[model samples]
Target: MNQKKTIILDLTGCKYFDELHERIRIAFDFPKGYGKNWDAFWDFMRTECDAEMVEIVGESTMPKEFLPQLELMHTVLSDLKIENAKYGWNFDYKIIS
Candidate 1:
């Protein structure tokens, strides 16, 4: 049987963008020089990772000040899904509050 890979990123105590980025880089094992920015994030999600699904949890506990960043993450993932479909890659991303 083939099993799809699932990666979970728990962002429970992340209060800042940098902290969130660092945690994601470590959790996802991003490359040594992974750029910690939205653009780089999209690029990595689109090209580097090979997961069938990615789950981001604890968003409700994130600082209100980081809402924009959270929203951007969601948007980027949505865009990536659309782009992936066009290229015949099955990818899915989810945010959990």
Candidate 2:
């Protein structure tokens, strides 16, 4: 059985964009000079980060004002999923409320 790496992002206390970005960057150990933006996030997810699966928790607790940012994250994760599938690698994202 191949066990894939899993990283969980608990958003229980995340409130702002910067906070969310910092938490994710630090959790995944993204390289230095990681721009805290959607484009950079997509790049990292698609080519830099190494985890086979990522789980984001506490979505229901996230601030409503951050909906757009959350959507962007979902989009990036979806793209990564597709990219990984093409390479015969497993990459997945899940959200738990």
For each candidate, what TM-score against the reference? 0.92, 0.91
Per-residue lDDT, model 2, residue 16, is 86
Deviation from native of the Cα of residue 2 in model 2, angstroms: 1.8
**Poorest 10 consecutive residues by lDDT, candidate 1:** 88-97
lDDT of 1 by residue, 1-97 (tens): 9888888989997887888988888877898788999898888887788888889989899889988888888898889889889989888988766
Clashing pairs for predicted structure model 2, backbone only? none
As a TM-score, model 2 comes out at: 0.91
Output the lDDT of residue 61, model 2: 88
RMSD of each: 1.1, 1.2
Local accuracy by lDDT, each model:
0.86, 0.86
Among these predictions, the greatest TM-score belongs to 1
True-vs-predicted CA distance for residue 78, candidate 2, Å:
0.4
User: Where's the lowest-lDDT run of ten residues in candidate 2?
Assistant: 41-50
lDDT at position 12, candidate 2: 82
